[model samples]
Target: PRLREELKKNYWIVDNGYNSFPTQIPGEGGEMLCDDEIGDNIIGVLFAAQDTTATVMTWVVKYLHDEPKLLECVKV
Candidate 1:
C-alpha cells in the first residue's frame, strides 16, 4: 500500500503514443508527464545510472591500478 501510494504520488502514467517527435530522441519523445513523474524518473534514473557507473568505474580503476602492465599494454 505504501509503495503504491508513493508510486501514485510520484508517477503519472501517460497514454501510449503520446510522445512522437519529429526526430528519434529516446525518452525525449514521451508525453508530457506530471511534475512528480518527471522528478521521479529523473531521480530514479540518476541514482541507477550513477550507481552502476560508479561501481564499474571503481572496478576498472582498481584493475588498472593493480595491473599497470596491462594498462600500459592497452595504452600502446
Candidate 2:
C-alpha cells in the first residue's frame, strides 16, 4: 500500500508527466509494470548492491592487512 502510494506520488509521474511502470521507468508509450515485478526488481537491486559492497570491503580489508603502513595511517 505504501509502495503504491509512493509510486503514485513519484516526482517524475507527478511533476514531469511521466507514466508509472511496475518495475521501471518505462519510455514513452510503454506499458505499466505490475507491483510484483517492481518488488522483485527492488529486491534484486538491494541484493546486488549489498553483495558488491561486501566484496569491495573484503578486498579493502585484505589489502589493508597486507600493507601495514597503510592500515596504520588509516587507523589515525
Candidate 3:
C-alpha cells in the first residue's frame, strides 16, 4: 500500500461513479478513471464495429465486381 499512498499523496484521485460501464480493472483508487469496469464493454463495442464494417465492405465490393456496367455508369 506504500505505492498507493505515495501516489495519492501527490495526486488527488476521486471516483465520481457517474458512468456504470465495465472497466479493465475492478474497484477504484488505481490508475483507472473512477474505478469503472470497462474491460468487456469496450472489447464488445470494438469487435461489433469492426465486424459490421468488414461485412458491408465485402458485399459492396462483390456487388461492384459482378456488375461492371453499373460500376462504369457511376464513374461518369
| Number of the top-ranking candidate, with lDDT as the measure | 2
In model 1, which runs have C-alpha deviations exceeding 4 angstroms?
A: 1-48
Task: Count the clashes in each prediction.
Answer: 0, 1, 5
TM-score head-to-head 2 vs 3, winner: 2
* lDDT by candidate, in order shown: 0.48, 0.56, 0.48
Give the alpha carbon lDDT tens digit for every residue of 1-76 in model 2: 5554555567556365342333444433454566466546545655777754454455557768999997897799
Q: Which pairs clash inside model 3?
A: 22-37, 22-38, 23-37, 23-38, 23-39
Looking at model 3, residue 68 earns an lDDT score of: 99
Instruction: For candidate 3, write residues 1-76 as lDDT tens digits.
Output: 7656644543432234222222223235555434124424344455788754454455446666899986796589
TM-score list, all predictions: 0.33, 0.36, 0.32
Superposed on all Cα atoms, the candidates' RMSDs to the truth, in angstroms, are 15.2, 15.0, 16.4
The reply for model 2, stretches above 4 Å from the true place, is: 1-48
**Candidate 2: pairs in clash:** 22-33
Q: How far out, in Å, is residue 34 in model 3?
A: 48
Order of models, best TM-score first: 2, 1, 3
Model 3, residue 8: displacement in angstroms?
A: 57
